[model samples]
Target: MCDTCGCQLHEHHHHDPKVVEVNQSLLAANVQQAMSNRQHIEKMGAVAINLISSPGSGKTTLLERTIEAMRDTVRIGVIEGDIETERDAERIRAKGVPAVQLTTGGACHLDAPLVHGGLHVLEHFAKGAGYDLIFIENVGNLVCPATFDLGEHIRVVLLSVPEGSDKPAKYPATFKGADLVLLTKVDLLPYFDFSMEEVRKEAGLLKPDLELMALSATSGEGFDAWLSFLDRRLNR
Candidate 1:
């Protein structure tokens, strides 16, 4: 019975709920765009990587460093996502690599459609220069971003040491969806309360085969593994 007006279930009543059986995931639109985006990325001669993490996880900084590290050996491009501003893309462009920024206005996550547009923009910037790998740095978010697929071959989730180690257990869905979990800002371990063991244990419980690495982008600690991982993915 409808508590507001007490309308009968079978009668022609406004209070009766429609109960439309639209058995569809909230990410349906995103999934469709992802399928198309994957094809688009392949056509552009590159594999894409979607990086997710909470605010201040050093995603942009890491990308800046990554461009310096791999731009010469591997043709790298980037699509930066943010609520507003093209600062990240500007930073990437300074590295002499083509980059495009997709500002979401107020969206918390970067969906596949936005990335699809960004890919085209990047192509325009490059104008047939080509890229071996495209990094779609997602909006700084650990929750809603996990639900949407940007057609990336690998989804990397970053966790800075200052954010602590309890994030995996706190946000299992994000951790489980990750193909690789990068623990950043590890150089600050002595000052922070982060526990490496706990983070790995929780993340492992969620995804038994989840690849993980601990490093600091600032200190250049544990970066070779990340570069190797990227090489393997691109070659594959």
Candidate 2:
């Protein structure tokens, strides 16, 4: 079978088995760490929310508004994930809450082990006051973050109005994995061609019973419902 400096060989040796095994082992380790992280969160007397979305979806802006609306009543903490800068964590810290920034270097996603470290840092900031809620803002990506669990009590996915309503259908894996979906930046809905009807229809097709909420961080529109949702979760 010598055609272009190719020698006769069997197909069984074409694939490397070690690579598959390594990947499986890595995932297994991540799952184990995630379970442990959940226990760690409960021990801190807090319920964690893992937030996933694309860049420019106003995740930080939403958090800023939320902290302002709730800081007086709810004990809050934040863990901001990003590829490089500590800018988001700084923003949250300015709001008078404990925030930890975990830079991924060049990775697209934040794994459970990385979050485990962030949780420890947050605990130090708690100073035994005990937190009511912990928000883990995952790096802005619709895909890779869905595959990893940060030991969060709930997973929230955000889709901004300008991003188009077709996102759910295009990125089914992310939408399908969400415990709750937030359609943000509704203030610009009139300017953009994004249809709320299409978003609901397509997202429903993927997750029939998925809880959905629409809000604009800038305008404070629909934000009361969002705060109420968080209140209910904390009460539970």
Candidate 3:
């Protein structure tokens, strides 16, 4: 039901004027909602981090380790986004932190409006105590999630060692938008053919001043810097 082409295909190769207008409108609304979300997060006395990565990139594992390491010091809350399953939220809950699972049903990304609801739920879980850090674990897709902001103060994009070093070059939009690029699963570096130098160069090309860190959540390798980074963000 395209208003321009009169064709049923809404996502055709040609740039339909109506489709472009609709997309722009949608993004505009999302941007407004995202700004509101940021204000809400600040009001809750929390700094939000949006974690974006492909599936199996160890985002949840990183959160698990992070929560275990700093839960006593930091008031942590999580909003888990996925196409289905509350498993991630349950895992965070086991670590004894408040987590809200937002199932998109089939959507590949979590938008600000959805996260706004999650923030309220997370606040209710706090019982007016509020949080020091809020983690929005975005749906595991490198592409769509990059285009939407969930009201996060910082956006972290994780690229596991096994995913290969060419990912930064392959997905420039995702890497370019990252505030921090985490090279996770460095413990498996020896097993994979991943090149650290290549990742550094490619990601540097995408974002010259991008902060990159390598860490193994399983082996606790290069984790101190990651924790320190969070500490600075929370303190600032």
Per-model TM values vs. the true structure: 0.89, 0.89, 0.89
lDDT of 3 by residue, 1-236 (tens): 77766778887545634633344555898999999999999998899999999999999999999999999999999999999999999999999999999999999999999999999999999999999999999999989999998899999999999899999999999999999999999999989999999999999999899999999999999999999999999945
RMSD of each: 4.8, 5.7, 6.8
Residue 226 CA displacement from its true place in model 3, Å: 0.3
Our tally of clashes for model 3 stands at 0
Q: How far is candidate 2 from the true structure (C-alpha RMSD, Å)?
A: 5.7
lDDT of 2 at 202: 92
Native-to-model Cα distance after best TM-score fit, residue 9 in candidate 3, in Å: 28
Residue 40 displacement in candidate 1 (angstroms): 0.8
Deviation (Å) of 175 in candidate 3:
0.3
lDDT of 2 by residue, 1-236 (tens): 55544658633334334533344655788999999999999988888999999998988999999999999999999999999999999999999999999999989999999999999999999888878899999999999999998899999999999999999999999999999999999999989999899989998999999999999998899999999999988834
Largest lDDT belongs to which candidate? 3
Ranking by lDDT: 3, 2, 1
Q: What residue pairs are clashing in model 1?
A: none
Screening candidate 2 with a backbone cut-off below 3 angstroms (N, C-alpha, C), the clashing residue pairs are none
Give the per-residue lDDT of model 1 (tens digit) for 1-236.
Answer: 76556766745456446668898987799889999999888887898999999989999999988889998888888999999998988999999898888999999998888888898988888778777899999999889899889999999999999898999999999999999999998889999887899997999999999999987888999998998899888855
